[model samples]
Target chain A: MNPRTSMMQGNIAVAEGAIAAGCRFFAGYPITPSTEIAEHLARSLPLLGGRFMQMEDEIAAMGAVIGASLGGMKSMTATSGPGFSLKQENIGYASITETPVVIVNVMRGGPSTGIPTLPSQGDVMQARWGTHGDHPIIVLTPAGVREAFDMTVQAFNFSERFRVPVILLLDEIIGHVHEKVTLPDPEDLVVIDRKKPTVPPEEYLPFEIDETMVPAMANFGEGYRYHVTGLVHDQTGFPTMDEVKIEMMLNRLHGKLDKYADEIIQVEETGTEDAEIGIICYGSSARSARQAMRELRDEGIPVGMLRIKTMWPFPTDRIRAFADRVSHLVVPELNLGQIAHEVEHASCDRAEVVRVNRITGDPIHPEEIVQKIKECR
Target chain B: MDYQKYLRNENFPHIWCSGCGAGIALKAILRAIDDLGIEQDDVAMVSGIGCSSRTTGYVDFNTIHTTHGRPLTFATGLKMARPDMTVLVVTGDGDATAIGGNHLIHAARRNIDMTVILYNNNIYGMTGGQASPTTPLGDIGTTAPFGAVENTFDISGLVIAAGAAYVARCTAFHAKLLDDLIRKGIEKKGFSLIEVMAPCPTAYGKLNKKGSGAKMILDQKDAAVRIAKAEKMTAEELEEKIVIGVLVDRDIPEYIQSCDAAVAQAMNARNGSA
Candidate 1:
């Protein structure tokens, strides 16, 4: 039998996708553009024997998500701009503790509540570095409604598998947009659970890792009775003042993602095999970039596009290889060249990076990108 | 009591200083848990960043030493996720009343099933001698070289007004009473707040000429008035007295049970519609 298709909003699709991914707990504070995700879960989760809590604030919500994750539940929280800022401290705690959680940050105008009701891709860098620390995080951005559902599932899977906090970065446009999404059957979709310790409780070291670089997680009440702390800890899960252990732990945290970048990093390239000019963008702006790419190609201009799905653990190698094939690459986003700077760094002088920027809480139009592409030509 | 059974021996030489009342409070908690026979794996202790927050490091339970001022929030999540597990929060005065005040009130308001053991040392012990929210007016702290000008918070009253199901106040001097209150708090199936008036001799004591840690603990004994006697005293008569005992205890709907009921109702509504 064919899967049932339904008309759904982007945030609703994300909430449904979380339920499909076996997320049993959601703790969130209501925020503009992202509040719908919480509202949807509030009504649906309890009916399915899942827990939904509207925490007092964003920080509390983030804390609750990490707490639930440590208790052996697939947990998540959603927020927008200012709320995201409030959650950074606990987000850092989740990072240092190697807790598996999914945070949905719906992009909005920022630099302190700039615009609440409109669209802007201003949190790209913040999602990458918002939490102050040299820690590992996986971030995924989805352009449309269906991708939003798919990426939410992928976010949970990656978080559980890597035992790292995963971020689903969405923009106001996609969050509010309504579209037809045919969700996959629960059986067909890939669902991953964090690896549990095989050793007896007495011998288990909470932070010990093998070649995978990701340690097996033990639930709070699972008789592990282990300790978890935000302070730099050794394999025994106890804080250590030894410099060598601190350095080793930090490296392991970063190396876990670096070694598995091939599995974590994802990018979609269209018409980029033989092109003179390329466009690189993500989230909502990628929609306009794709339109411009198709229009330019149809007009007989050698143009292609690289759409970023995984924003962190950035596809640097792929961007460099693409730049080697193209003379110019246009990086257009809703912010002031956040990703453009990253593209310039990644392209490594192989391509002259041109930036088409927008910061008025409005979607970047295809005409705007087409005009920029023509200027580059 | 077999203190070693509940203690993580490797983390010994704890950060608490000599005469630090937090050690006494920790002992009371361990004794309470031991008396109640809560399994090591069944209890989860969470603490914020402070000298008192160090309690989790020495405990053998499933413990987490979380960020500054946020142990209650984390405990709320852990409790909601695993309702079967007993959750306890250990926080300092500054950690709970200053930075984490919002969480403290909200947790009480939600009436979640958890026990909060608040160590009110009246000053920030770990970060030098800074005046905390519980620091009394005119008490000298490093931040208040002359004297603390700000009025202090009545923590137990705050939790009571915020709708906690159980609220108690005890002092490190009242070690036996502290253990009994904690045992009752753990047995209470809703949000329980037990504010322990722990002394900070190195910080608040030395700055204010409160003599030694033992002397400061003895002062708690003189200042405390049992709840029954204090009820009949006038405001002026009770001004210097720290009313110590169970201040609030009543039956209320616990958060997790309400959540389960809401879920059942929702499922029933859906089934009816189908």
Candidate 2:
């Protein structure tokens, strides 16, 4: 088992990664391109003494994940397109309550179930702002099956550490794409659990925080007998409408992620040191960007690639520097410039930002990106 | 019973208005929990958005005030993960029958071990007297100025059809009976739904000319008939009468236990193969 290697699909790898990360509960509703994740966990979790429930709908699935998280289990759920839309309310609940849970949105074309069986990175912005209100959330876009596995584990760790909901944003291609990879031994993996209250039940305050900005969470039925609510809450974890307390609560939620943005943001860069043309992408779209960059560089064109892993806390500084160094920056996503707009904002007039978008329910091929980069060059 | 033992005194002067039957229902629930002798630490009180959902904020258990119409889903997951704990849900007519109808039926179908205390206020009281699924036909609400044309939901009958192990209906007027029914619902090993027919004096009562909270409760007392007595009445006689008592109680394989058994079998097979 030390040299565990296998050909696996992206969704299967996520399930495997969840198992390895000690996620004891999974509640999900089946949606195309993401159904395999629920199916895999249904077969695997019970064997590991973990719980898997296929909820009535995506909203219920998200609610269940948050509940199980409160019950002291690392929990997750998966869905796509319209299902992701259905989950936004509960996702908002998890955000406000600061419950640790993981959500996997296997992106497919959609305003409403546009194309279920096809690939698209259309949900990138929705991952950030889908849940109503201003709240803190982490979104990770995995580019391949291996990264899906690695990032799923990272998602649980981040959610536990920050007590924030983490979204593993995968596209249809990534969900179904099969890749051969050697996964690390379980003994060698780094797993993180939510910080528990060190104080006695009488002294415990469920939402109190120090410099870490993340409160120690006491699981339900642990005798800490605390309150949890979606409403704006004070340190006591009860609802509050006092203006000062509301501002303080919102500030801590946003500030926690912002304070550690440097450590939380992850990206991989290649050939950007001397290249005049740079392509910035994530998820399966980044796969095409890498191929396009390699092809262009071989043709004596100065091209580079920056693939984003942590899509939220958005790596603004790194992307800004990359944009500044390059004369032209190309953002190739399945949606119409969701991240390209962010790149344009991050570029801050330092460079020309061009978007190569395709929403035809098909993956953007390397050639399309190559054509865009060549045009910019 | 000492109410202070379970009540979160800090959250006092609760959001429930004067004459709101939610307070009555909450007292009955605490009394039932007291009767069962379950520790406050082991009882998880969950609720959805509504006047009833605010019930969690008043209690000192492992309380969770979840999104609208979604407490049962959350409770289901919590119970599945922590089967050692007793999970209870407090929901409203609008929350349970309209927005969260699917979860209610499915939770019953799975026969999960949970006791649901549904407050049937007949109108969306929190939102100011809007018509809900349980608003009786011809009743007036903010949304139904003339008269409500939509058919009302028979909540107990719905859960019974959906396979609840225990189903009961009791009005806020019958405080002792409500307490007993809640205790019975909690004691049942599978899904239990105890619909508490509560009056919303400020909203539903005002709009429908249903008199003050006390007067409405008196109306409930007059309309209520014990199920044993109602059994002898014909359908026409039973119409417009509230049949108050445990409606269904049966033995069934509880969901969490069945899941645990399956997990054990799978582990055993794996060990045997290894």
Cα lDDT, all candidates: 0.92, 0.92
Over B62-138, each residue of candidate 2 has an lDDT whose tens digit, in order, gives 99999999999999989988998999999999999999999999999999999999999999999999999999999
DockQ of each: 0.87, 0.84
Q: Candidate 2: which pairs clash?
A: none
lDDT of 1 by residue, B56-174 (tens): 99999999999999999889889878999999999988999999999999999999999999999999999989999888899888999889999899999999999999999999999
Q: Show how many residue pairs clash in every candidate, following the order shown.
A: 0, 0
**How displaced is residue A341 in candidate 1, in Å?**
0.4
Query: What lDDT is reached at residue A158 by model 1?
Result: 96
Candidate 1 stretches with Cα past 4 Å from truth are A1-3, B272-274
DockQ metric, candidate 2: 0.84
lDDT of 2 by residue, A1-377 (tens): 44588889999999999999999899998899999999999999887778999888888999999999999989999999899999999999999999999999999888797988998888888999998999899999999998899999999999999999999999999999999988888999999999998989999988985788999999998889999999899999998899999888889988999988987999999998988988898988888889898899899999988889899978888989998888988999999989999998899988899999999988889999999887875
TM-score of candidate 1 to 2 decimals: 0.99
Q: Name the lDDT value of residue A317 in candidate 1.
A: 89
Q: What is the lDDT, from 0 to 100, of the residue B137 in candidate 1?
A: 94
* lDDT, candidate 1, A89-166, per-residue tens: 988898989999999999888779889988988998899899897879999999999999999999999999999999
